[model samples]
Target: MTASDPSGPFRLLAQCPPGLEPTLTRELAALGIPAPHQTPMAGGVMWNGGWEQLLRANLHLRVASRVLVEVGSFRARALGELVRKGRVAVDWERIRAAAGGDGRRIVFRVSASRSRLYHEGAIEARLREAGELPDVAGVGEEAEPRTRDPGEAEEFPGVAGPGDRADAPGTPILVVVRVHRDQVTVRLDTSGAHLHQRGYRQHVGTAPMRETLAAGLLLQGPLEPDGGWSRPSLVDPFCGSGTIPIEAVLLARRIPAGMASVGFVPRDFACLHWPDLPPDVWEMEVARARAGIRPLDPERFAVFGSDRDARVIEAARANAKRAGVPEEVHLATAPLSKAPHPDDSGWIVTNPPFGTRLGARKSLRPLYAALGRSVQPGGRMVGWRLLYLSADPVLDHATGLPLEVRMTTRHGGLTVRAVAAR
Candidate 1:
């Protein structure tokens, strides 16, 4: 029982595509997190929970792009009052303790939609005063205190105030201020860096899809959720560096996304400064991840990747091996139209060349047409859903096969639309 859990429920905010909100909501429900309330804002969703629920959401959520903790929300007509109220609302002492030994690096983000009291700089100033600005020195003059990239040490400028010292351990806080019609809502970021990194992809091809996007696309498929991959036979006909199949294996095995990554924003955050987060808890997390990993059945799941470019296929094979799923994934050099069929009912998901970067515009239509024909009736075919992302809408029309649009999502700045036919 941590102090946060006993004090009261914590408010959490998660961001995802508008169309996929229902799916994300369902995902939260499965994890036992309180049902989230949908906000009218674009690309934002709200939920409430304590520290335990926050950790669970970070570990188990497959659809959320990022998870944030709500610190406070209030109405402030002017900048002065806003800062004063924000500082008083948050428990700075508790936050400082959670950050390990570093004073909380308070980050502020302001968003205003149709509001008269629209001043981003003012909101930021208030947040800094409230967070007890750490002393950051030697940074360049152009450096804005809040937007400093974590990778650049010189950019951080040491600490902001006299209280910030090397030996002083405190929580690093990120404050996001959203002002709509005089209403100011402030939130502290709990999950740093978009949740999609998942850490494992050491090798990237010319263009690689994010793990989160791949998972969302898979969720739109016919794959069962309840440990269905025990004997899973997954195939990505256009597997670029094997992201889809790799993510599938991770989810099937219940591996934590951060296990493979060296650094995450959460690791350097102030929340870990809290005394409640004992070192044993982190060790236990690692232990659970290790125990959950089971040897994948090469014959059953039979993960496979195919690409027209032999070099890309080679890269995918090497990447799968690096991710520890080499034996499970069978990489081969084949075009989408010529890829071998695993089983009549097997899942066939791919992100075919969209001809956006590669000079393959002339070949897209025919390639999509051939792909549609390849998936015989009663089999599944999922592809990038966005109309602009790919030049093959005719593929759906050409297959002369009945198709259903399952979900629409965004991947790497391109909107993706997933389709399936049973």
Candidate 2:
């Protein structure tokens, strides 16, 4: 309960976009989490590790959306039972410490199905009566698994970014409660904002990709498989706001996605305020992660991006600069038809327009066809892999490539698949 008291191993879950479980597992494995400890589920990876692993997951894992710690679980068949069982099950002292010594408002996201206490509002009300808990509010409508890039900033109002004091007033602590049948489970959201809000993307264009999803595509998609953590040259012709290129460089350079990079500030997490966490532990882990970053070798590893819109190109430049890879990520303003072909065949990964409107699909056919031709101008990219996000298989066929659907996921409120011509 207190910082000095001995606590058991933390039950940690690294949540990611659905369909990225395997990728997330591999990332954890690379982070030195043993195979026996990792349990890959539908939308996240679970493991029982100590405090350092939790800090490493939040500070270094690129594809995860958030990291959560399970505090308690108990059987509560009725409201009264729920109050008694939940009160005993939850470590209220730990919660108080995590709330920075009480009176802080905690957001409770509650969901119930096939349970006796099916009323979510009543469940929250009863849970509030459990102890001298902090003021609670409901985070209405659980967010759908993020499969696409965010367009604008939706960070929590009082949350802190990197280098800022973590004890900002009104900074929220989120507690998740789920009930099924006769069982109740509770989790604490250590990630204050979504993991994709890495703080570099201050500017964005239409239909931009999320940084986490972009890293997933690069890790799992087709590539030339260069040895020793080195990746092949990456090019994104439809690179709006430069998420793919920036993530590509970050991945190859071994940069911590959530750590501060040059001009970009890092975002704060809920766990930073927990009293059980020693300040030196976080500082040491951050220092260790910073030491892991290696510079990209431009000759062997090049990342290029270009967009037809001049305005977004400027945004991409600014974003790349903030991400500490301005020189590594080359950007230009050109239509897909005029996209320059790289001398060396590597990989082309992009999120093209999905044409989600009523009849826009018909209008984008020629552009898809042009994408097929432009990348292969003069047979320069004959062996290069083309990986893209496609909402319609019909549009993929228009590219005149024998592309296979690699992974099906959501993007921009539409069902999209990562199709690839390997």
Report the C-alpha displacement of residue 196, candidate 2, in angstroms: 0.7
- Tens-digit lDDT track of model 2 for 1-422: 22111233788888887777777887887787766678886668888877788888888788788888888889898999988887789877766777775466666667787888888767877887885563343443333222223322134445555445556776667667778777887888887777787777878998888898788787755431111332367889899999988988887777788863684334577787787787887887777777777888878888889999999999999988888788989899998766665677778889988887758998988889877765464544566778888888778878887788777666556667788874
Instruction: Report the CA-based lDDT of candidate 1 relative to the real structure.
Output: 0.57
Q: Which 10-residue span in candidate 2 carries the lowest summed lDDT?
A: 144-153
User: Per-residue alpha-carbon lDDT of model 1 for 1-422, expressed as tens digits?
Assistant: 53123243667777665556666766666555434343423555566556665665665566676666766777777767776786787656544553445344554556675676676665666656766766343122223444432221111223221112322433234445778887877766555445665545656778787666677766765343323542346677788788877767756655544443222112222233347755665555456546655656656566667777787777777766655566666778887656655652466676777765445655566766666656554424433221112324554565555667777666555555676654
How many pairs of residues collide in each model? 36, 2
lDDT of 2 at 73: 84
Model 2, C-alpha of 325: deviation from truth (Å): 1.3
